[model samples]
Target: MTTTSLPIVSTCGTTGCSYNHDSDCHAGAITVTQGCGTYVDVAGEAGIDTRAQVGACHRSECVHNTALECGADSVAIGPSGGVADCLTFATA
Candidate 1:
């Protein structure tokens, strides 16, 4: 099923992600692949109020993914394989 609203990014532990501040994701939206496709390793911060939402998800095998979008109530991102990943991803 399709989700009416974007999924909230509850937390992020990607240390070098530009969208991450104080362990929270501030990107307007994030793309989930094997890793976080939208992760930027720059030296800046997204607006403090700009909480991230899942814009797209490529893990079709993930239970939280529906129609290329995230259907989870919330998702967490973290460091994995030297990149950001969707820690909430689970097999169907």
Candidate 2:
């Protein structure tokens, strides 16, 4: 599979963010928590493998979170998950 680098947004300093430290998203999987009442995937671009490339959520309203930590009950990959700005993210 061709590996393509997707443009990642910085993780916002909102509570419950995954990319809080060094923006090191190595999970290769992403899912939006339920409490935020929304779902967003940071890995779904062409040539980008969401299951093989780790990513971080920049959305502050994500339900799967609690102070920059992934609090989601489950995580999955799909095409609906788009990119967003992480208000708390910074370049490593």
Candidate 3:
């Protein structure tokens, strides 16, 4: 099988996360975007483009967080308790 390197999974620091396997995201796909729990369409702040490119994550408590980007090969989102949380969040 051929693999494309477009979307890379960010390392998850949430041990409570399901997709987190030894600080690595095995979901193979993840969504990266700003704004959590609620909408923040405030003025002054530039609007961010929300796309599922497994690009970067907004989670700060994650270990694999570098410049807000995921380092995993890929990650899986959804089936969350509420918002689309990183299934690979492990605590430091």
Of the candidates shown, which would achieve the greatest TM-score relative to the real structure?
A: 1
Candidate 3 residue 89 Cα shift, in angstroms, is 2.3
Give the local distance difference test score of model 3.
0.46
Estimate the TM-score of every prediction. Answer: 0.87, 0.28, 0.42
Residue-level lDDT tens digits of model 2 in 1-92: 11244223223222233332333333344433322222233344222322222233444455543454443323333222233222222232
Off by over 4 Å in 3: 1-52
The local distance difference test score of model 1 is: 0.84
Q: Which candidate tops lDDT?
A: 1
lDDT of 1 by residue, 10-87 (tens): 999999888888998888788999988888887777545767888899999999887888889989999867588889
- In model 1, the worst 10-residue window by lDDT is 42-51
lDDT of each: 0.84, 0.32, 0.46
